[model samples]
Target: MSVQGTPDELVEILRETVVSLVRRDGPDLSARQLGVFLTVYLGEGPHTVRGLAEALNIGKPAITRALDRLEEFKLARRKINPADRRSVHVQRTTRGAALLREISVTMAEAANPQRTAGTPTGSQQGLKP
Candidate 1:
C-alpha cells in the first residue's frame, strides 16, 4: 500500500519522530532546546550567547539556561572567544555530533513506516521523488 501525504504533513511526522528520538536518548532536553541547538549549529556565527538569544527570539537568560542544560549533558561546549575574552562561543562536542547522527538515523527510519513491510529491498526503499 502506498502512503501519501502533503509536505507539511510529512514534516509534522518528521518532527514527531525527532521528538521521540530526543525523549529516548536525552529526556532532559526539551524540544525548544533541540531547536535552539539546530539553529546555532546551522547558523553563520560565532554562536555567542547574545547571538543565540537573538536568533531564537528569546531572552538571554533563557538562552543561558538552555546552554546550561546542553552543557550538563556534555553535548555542547562554551568557551571564551579568544578574539574577545568577554565573549563566548558555543560549539557541539563529539557527543553532540554522535547524538545528532543517531537522532537523524532514527528519524529516517521512523519517517518511512513502509519499511516494516519487507518488500522492495535495498536503497530505493519507496523514497518518492
Candidate 2:
C-alpha cells in the first residue's frame, strides 16, 4: 500500500505524539502491550486469548503476560465466558477506554499543522516551517 507524507513529516508527527503523551504522564506501555491493547480496544470484540494471540502473531503465554499487566494496571480484564467454560474473554476497563481517548487526542494535536511553537518536533520544540 502507498503511504502518504514524507519521512520527515511522519517522523515529526511521531516525535510530537510521544512528547505529548509523555507530558501527560501516561503509563509506559511496551510495544507488544500497546499492540494488544489497541487491537482489543479498537477492534470489535468479545476478544479471547487465543484470538488475540493469533491476531498479534504472538504466543498465548505472551498474550497472557500482557493481559496480566493490563489487569494489574486496571486497563483490561478477563472473564470466563458463560457460554463456553473453557474460554476466556478480554474486556476493556473504563481506564483503558479513557486512555485510548487520550492517545487519540494527543496524536491529533501533534499532527495538526497549525500546532504552536511549544509543540515537540523531532529534534527541537518547534515545528519546521
Give lDDT per model, in order: 0.74, 0.84
Identify the runs in model 2 with alpha carbons over 4 angstroms from their true place.
1-4, 116-120, 125-129
Task: List pairs with backbone clashes in candidate 2.
Answer: none
Q: What is candidate 1's lDDT per residue for 1-129, written digit by digit as tens?
A: 354678864775666575567567464577778877777666776698998988888999998888888888887889999989999999878888787777777766756767435644323454542
Clashes by residue pair, model 1? none
Task: Write candidate 2's Cα lDDT for 1-129 as tens digits.
Answer: 344668877776776666666677667777788889999999889999999999999999999999998888888999999999899999999999999998888777766778745655555644453
Best by lDDT: 2
lDDT assessment of candidate 1: 0.74
Against the hidden true structure, what lDDT does model 2 obtain?
A: 0.84
